[model samples]
Every structure is written in structure tokens, then in C-alpha cells.
Target: MNAEPPPPAPQWAVPPEGGWTADDLDTLPTLPPHTELIDGSPVFACPQTVFHSRAVSFFSGHLLSSAPPGLEPVARFTIDIDRSNRPEPDVVVVRANAVESLRQTRFPASNVLLAIEVVSNDSVTRDRETKPVKYARAKIPHYWRVENHDGRAVVYVFELEPATGAYTSTGIFHDRMKVSVPFPVDLDLSAIAPRPRAADPQ
Candidate 1:
């Protein structure tokens, strides 16, 4: 007789009372990697694509170089929005002194200068609609949404409106990005990703 198969893995369950807390994100061993907490619920991120990876890298690098000494650029880090929400932005510009430890995983919303989200197919709604509202409400001064358009990057810049507690579109950049707020940011968007070469004629 063939050997019996090993037992199946246990399914992960959430506490029904209030869904997932920010702390549960760190404590849950079985949770998928890059799992984000949104409105007391766990939202999982799909696998990254080449465009997403390249765009994130380009933005992080530019922010790292352009940010002032008091600010630092961090990539793929979670922000402690509140007890229920801890969304990890693709790139964040934060106060250098706000981090308590070298191993700190999350930063308070107040410490963040700018939050960036690079749009992926699976994250369009969250990045375009949901997260922007949350970030604006948290009073994050600046927000940038990067999307791949025909092998190039397009940036949608937003600034928080304090009176309304919402974000207003400051500008939209296609070929290049030049922003004065949230520190001076100037980059050639064309270099965000390596484009495919045209085929040679026979």
C-alpha cells in the first residue's frame, strides 16, 4: 500500500469581533507576506511584476537622494495608521528621528512626510481609491500614485487639504516629475523601467 499523505495545513481564521488589528499582522505566522491591514481587515498583496519592482526601485532611489537630512526615504514599509490599518506603501519619506529602533517595522502617520503607492493590476482600486482617502485623513502631507503607462511611469501627485481632511490633485506628471512640495523631487520618468527593444527587420 502507498504511504499516507501528510496532514493538510490548518486554515487561518480571523477574530470576528473587529476583524484584524494592526498588531495581528505581525503576530500571525500563517499570514501571507506583504499582508496589509485595511479597515480592520487583512488585505493581501499579489505577487509583484517587473514594472512594479522597477518603478518602486526608481522612486525609492530618487526620494533617497532628494530628501533633506531630516527626512529619509523607506521602501516597502508599513505605516501604523491606527489600530485597524497598517498599509505598507511602496515608498515613504519619513522623519529621520521618528524611528525608535533600527529594526522598527512601522512608523506613525504623523512622522510620514510623503506616502507613495505604485499601482499594480491587483492594487489599482486600493491605490487609486481607498488608500488615498485613508492617507489624507491621517494627515500625511503628500501622496504620489505611480502607474505604468506604455512602458513608462506616470505620477499622480496629491496634497492633503487640511480643512476637508482630503487629498486634492496637485499635478500629473508623465515624461518628467518635478514637485516642490514634500521636498524637491525631479526625475525623468522615462528611466523608471527598461523598455523592450524593437525587432530588427530581416
Candidate 2:
């Protein structure tokens, strides 16, 4: 006799009223791709455009290579802010010393030095409006938003206002970006231009 085939994963298995937590998310047998738990509900991450991936790759490489001692950049990692908010930033700069203390899959907001978001058409409201407020309230020291405009990458850098727990826009970069806050970083943004894809064979 042939062996039985494995069962397919449940289409919908949200927990009963209380909502999904990080612990519950970990217990899921299989999660859909590009998924994030939002306020105890699962929200699929926005699909990435080719340009988006290239920009992230470029920024990650640049930031990691030049990061100050005891700090490093992490991409596509979840930050546990609270029961209601656990956003996975596109990239985050975190303290090296706290890497071990973070849960196997997620970091606490307190450990994050900076949180970054690469804006997608579908995520403009969330990235530009919603998440910034959340990160600022979480007391993250810095936040960066990257978007392309007029055929060039634009970076909006923000710093936290400790008293208000809000972010103040510090610098906006259109070409070569130079800043000294949290740490000094000098970056060239030319590679952020969207590349042309080869035409498919007819």
C-alpha cells in the first residue's frame, strides 16, 4: 500500500478572540510568504518591486559596511513593540550587545537604534504615516524613509524628540547623503535608480 500524503495547512486558523501574539505566530505550522502579524492579525507584506529590492540591497550593504563599532544593520527583522504592534521594519540598525537577548526571531524595540522603511506604492500610507508614529512612540532613536522621486532616491532622516516621543525630520537627501547622528554616514544614492529588465523571448 502507498503511504498517506500529508495534509495541507489550514487556510485560516486565527486564534480565538484574544488574538495572535509573537509566541502564537511561532507555533504556526507554516506561514504564508511576506507575512507580518499586525495587532494580533496576519497581514501579508506588500510585494516588492525590482527597484525596491535593489534599493534595500544597496542600503543594507552600505550601512553594514560603515556601521560604527557595536552596531549593525539588520534587514527584514521583526520588532516586538507591544501586544498590539509588532512591525517588521525593512531594515534596522541594532546594538550588537543585545543580539543574544532578543528572541530567536524578533527584537525588542528598545534594542533598535534605527528603523528604516522603503516605501512601496501599496504601503505609502503605512510607511509614511502609520509606522513612523509607532516607531517614535516606541522610543526608537531614529527612523529613515527612502523613496524615489524625479528619477533619484530621496532619503528622509528623522530623529526622536525625547520629550514628545515624536520624530523631527532632520535631513532630506536627494543625491549624496551625509549625516552625523546616531553615527556618521556618507552614502551615494546613484544605484537606487530602477534598472531596465531584458525583454522576454518571444
Candidate 3:
């Protein structure tokens, strides 16, 4: 059997600074096509597509609205798992009190109660594979995948089992399914379904 091509090197192995350092990442040019440091290597994320943008906005809004008094909903924010990796998840749920502190510096992974990723055409694999492994490895408690395609929405919830470094599938909630997280609330998936727009009449 052909040797499985060596697993792609961790994104952090290459140094944009000639030497990996936080100062190098901070000082790098900040311009269009924002780059995030993952495992010390720079990963460029493209601008969100209309569908991707809408899904993120809708889900984030709902999470925020439903969150209990002590839980905070944050959107498109970076979470720094370590010096080598800082990923910006689509939506994150954290403790209400840690919001200000997380905003002031690199976002803390410890305080993140859940991390959500909305699938974009370009990033489906990275979001589904790379990020899941990374999040599981970091021992983050919950990870959610929101897929928007084929005129439908599908949400998958994975609860992490750190001992195995794997995320056990908890539940898959589709349209109309009520899904519960560890928190006190449950989400109605239909509330976030994508509605097709009417075609202009000829």
C-alpha cells in the first residue's frame, strides 16, 4: 500500500516570523484576508459567503437570546488554545463574567463552554476535521457543526471525551428537532433553518 502521505504537518510548524513568537504574529501586517495562527503557521480564511454569513448570524443571535443570565454568547471571536494556535470560531458560548477579560487579550479556551463552526464551501474539511481534532485535543467540552447547504440546515453536536482525545457523537439535530446542550436550555433547529428566497417574477 502506498504509504499514507505523512499527515500534513501541523500548521504551526512554519514560522512567519522566521522564528515562532507571539510578537511576530501580532506585528504581521493586518490587512484584507485576515490570517489566524494555527499551531504557529498562518491560515488564511476567506471572506464569508452569503449563506455562511447568514447561518452564523442567525445561530449566534439565537444563542445569545437563549443564553441564561450567567452564560454569554460571542460570535466570530478568536480563542487562543495555546501560543501556537489561535482560531476564530464562528460562535462561542462562555461565562458572562469572562467576556471582558477574554476580549482584552487572547481569548481563553478554558472559559469557552462551547464552540460552533458554520460550514463554508472552502472550509468544510478544515472546520469539520482539523478544528474538531484541535478542539478535542484542547479538551474543550463541546463542539457543534452547523452545515448549510442543499437548501437545508443540519446541526451535529459532539461532546468531548478528553481521555481518548476524541469527540463522541452526542446527537444530530435536523430541522424541527429540539436539541439540548449541557446548559439549561434546548434549541429548536427549525428556528435557524435557511429559507430560499423567491425568484423574481418574469
Best by lDDT: 1
For every model in order, what is the number of clashing pairs? Answer: 0, 0, 3
Tens digits of per-residue lDDT for model 1, 1-202 = 9999987663335465877789887777788888889998888888888889999899899888888899989999999988989999999999998878998778998999899999999899999999998998889999999998887889999999888889999999999888889878789999877876899988
Which segments of candidate 2 are over 4 A away from where they belong? 1-15, 101-103, 195-202
Local accuracy of candidate 3 as per-residue lDDT tens digits, 101-137: 5336446788888999988887888788998888887
The lDDT values for all models are: 0.88, 0.83, 0.75
Give the winner by TM-score: 1 or 2: 1
Which ten-residue region of model 3 has the weakest summed lDDT? Answer: 23-32
Worst 10 residues of 1 by lDDT: 7-16
Each model's RMSD to truth, in Å? 2.5, 4.4, 8.5
Model 1: lDDT of residue 47:
85
Better of 1 and 3 by TM-score: 1
- Write one digit per residue (lDDT tens) for candidate 2, span 81-115: 88857788889999987688555788889989999
Measured on C-alpha atoms, candidate 2 has an lDDT of 0.83
Task: Show the lowest summed lDDT stretch of 10 residues, model 2.
Answer: 8-17
TM-score per candidate, in order?
A: 0.91, 0.86, 0.79
Which candidate do you rate higher for lDDT, 1 or 3? 1
Highest-TM-score candidate = 1
